[model samples]
Target chain A: MNQTAMAENKAITISFPEELSEVQEMVRACIQCGTCSGSCPNEFAMDFTPRRLWRMVLMGQKDDIFKSKTFSLCSSCYYCTLRCPRGLPLTEAMAALKQIAAKDGLSKYKQSSLFYKSFLESVRRHGKVREMEFMTMYFTAMKSPFLPFRFAALGMRLMGKGKVHIQIPSKGEGKLKAIFRKVEEMEGR
Target chain B: MNYLYYPGCSLEGSALEYNLSTIAFMEAMGIELTEIEDWTCCGASAAESVSHLLSLALPARNLALAETMELDADLMIPCSACYLNLRNVAEKIKKEPDILNEINTVLKEDNLELKGDIQVRHLLDVVATDLGADSLAPKIRKSLDGLSIAPYYGCQCLRPYTVFDDPEKPTTMEPLINVTGARVHAWDMGGKCCGASHMNTKMDVGMELVAAILRAARGADAVVTVCPMCQMNLEAYQKKISATYGEDLSMTILYLPQLIGLAIGLSDKDLRLDLNLSITESFRNKLNNDCVK
Candidate 1:
């Protein structure tokens, strides 16, 4: 551990990343309502609940907050955000946390990260998601030899029905490249 | 009435049935929907986690393109994710001009700009409000009599920013379903989450959430939903979720437009009911049968 960082951790006021300063200020409204945690559809599997995570934010546990899988597993359902009694924009905060997790390389959900990367790969290639090819890439990338076959029967069924497409098609939106490139340069990712 | 339809990525690919039924429903009502030319993915749940700017810019780019075209009608999105992404653009631009300017500065390189004045609407909003019940009543060619169904309005359609209908306890789709004579089964879990991207991220948990919805909708003929992701999750994961939950959860998940299209006399080829995963035999028979006078 870096001596300065460890020392700063012991101090009463610790420094946070520039973006988190805003979050840190807004989360002060949290009353530990537990409504968000209760309402989250996937909270049953979380290592730390959203309520606890909000508490951590209040406590300035920046390292723990970044490393936690709480936000990475959000799924962007916006249930908690909509149902929050405090009207905290909880989902937006989770999205911001996801960005922080991505930028800092702090995501604990490898599968989640893998899936997002695969989705982005498809979008970059054709500007649309070819589900069959995306799943193939995802299982192959994750080194799961059995998963694709497991999904094959269902995939074929969907393909037969024209639900799961077998062909790769592009929207031919060349301007998308410019938009993506600009965002990449802006985000420095 | 005319509208610029944004089908998004999933609609063109995995959720093609949603696209089919929405078009059929729109067509039957004599509403013209012109697809936004060269529209790309909204970046959905993926971009928001990867880069905030990417999330905003991806959808904003589509809006920018729509602006450049000088489209005649308000943009209408059938997919909940696309609707949320497109509808939020104007609000985002107005709420954060610095970020808007920053994104605009980036977009200036492409000879495009993200304008905040563009009106974005969801397909449900157009059907329920613009078309109205009276306008739709006479159009019903086939009656959905004795066909029991539950309306599943999953996340993103009415939340984060509810453009149409009440955020909680949405009954907007009730009258639309009622007009078809299909019984609208009132359930408490209507506006709940469908474990969204978790299907790809966390499979087991996703199945559990789907199982809960299935259990909640046990006796109904099908769970009629507006979101493609929700439909996909509830249907595609049936076997796995049934196995996981130790129950035979053979629940039929339907697109809202599919239900509407069928009730309004659209054919199987038109709405593409064959694309549905967990098919209900009764639903099919009724769909294929001639409209009851």
Candidate 2:
């Protein structure tokens, strides 16, 4: 019910990271050896492999690369970086592209962003992630009812067994109030 | 060396077993993880995605708290998302003076600032680098002879910034797995995404991704991970993902600490087997009768 969550709930344009020089350097490191394609575990599943992504970036095809399904299929695993004979940071570039895609609202990463926001909100409130019950409830309310029941049941059992503390420790302690307020303001809540 | 430990949010929640086992296991390994006094959240996955400043500020607040605690050692974060957020802010502030100023100004209210001296390390990094494979190799109370473990890094720990080991095909975990007397299964899905938080929002998309990772881990007895989110996503969604893909990749998902505890002769109960989805009667029987003796 805090303002930050409200702002996140709003339909607003989000900005992506500026074109990173570091990412450019990483793109240039790709020697087009196709080793990245060979080492990519999900290459067969993805439309564009790591080799093609680097090639597209180098060819000034940022828009096409960003819009492709290849970026979404990236698991952020370091296989391409590990296999790149040129040692280009493929995963980082993927992350940058993902961030840019999210900012541009080109990809359907809003759910991913919401998940991250809700997690931080829970942490900020509880000083830990003891809100699985609430998280399950919130996510379910958001319409994803077939979520993981195992974790929710596990959380409840832990709470009942004194293994987990169900209450937020910061209750009445204004320590997080200022930080939470700043977060709210930054989120434009 | 002594270090301030940040278990992040998941250690205390869904992955509480990881926290419990980590504390016990680290004590056994002669390492001390002093929890920061009155520590706040590292903002995990969401804050960073929505607002860059929000992400930086969230972890910066925790960094400030660590500085205030005046801990002499680096901050050891066990959760991948928390580790990335803290490390990301630390790296960002150094390059972008304005980010440092903005985050520091926000921390000013609490009389805090992120002292870049506090080095952040994942628990895997601690076990691998700080503990050293040779040192750990000597302390294996029980050797896992027949157990096959797939070391899944789950993105945030090593990617986005090559701060740790090889980002692509990282095997920083291999040495730890090796030291634990277990076989590290060679798999391309070691660092693949386990759908992360999306498993909650987009079940179809998330389950497909989770299924792919599980397929890659087909032959392994268990998948050992360093992230709670990864563990949760893989373990909690296994049945659903399996049913969707019509494949029975009955893989037991565990945090590194839990696996370490098992290797060090801790009983399954001691490692909290009740929380795992794949720790069924068959798997438990397999552990007791087959390997890890």
Q: Model 1, residue B282: displacement in angstroms? A: 3.6
Each model's C-alpha lDDT?
A: 0.78, 0.70
Best by lDDT: 1
Interface RMSD of each: 1.6, 4.0
Query: What TM-score does chain B of candidate 2 reach?
Result: 0.95
TM-score of chain B of 1: 0.95
RMSD of each: 4.1, 6.3
Using all chains and alpha carbons, the TM-scores for the candidates as numbered come to: 0.91, 0.77
How would you encode candidate 2's per-residue C-alpha lDDT over A4-94 as one tens digit per residue? 6665455534343235444566688677889877865456656687788778877756555654566555554555766666777676677
> How much of the true A–B contact set does each candidate keep?
0.79, 0.43
Instruction: Enumerate residue pairs that collide in model 2.
Output: A78-B167, A78-B168, A79-B168, A116-B45, A116-B46, A117-B46
DockQ for each model: 0.62, 0.30
Lowest lDDT sum, 10 consecutive residues, model 2 chain B, at B44-53
lDDT of 1 at B256: 87
| Per-model TM-score of chain B | 0.95, 0.95
Docking class of 2: acceptable
Measure candidate 1: CA RMSD. 4.1
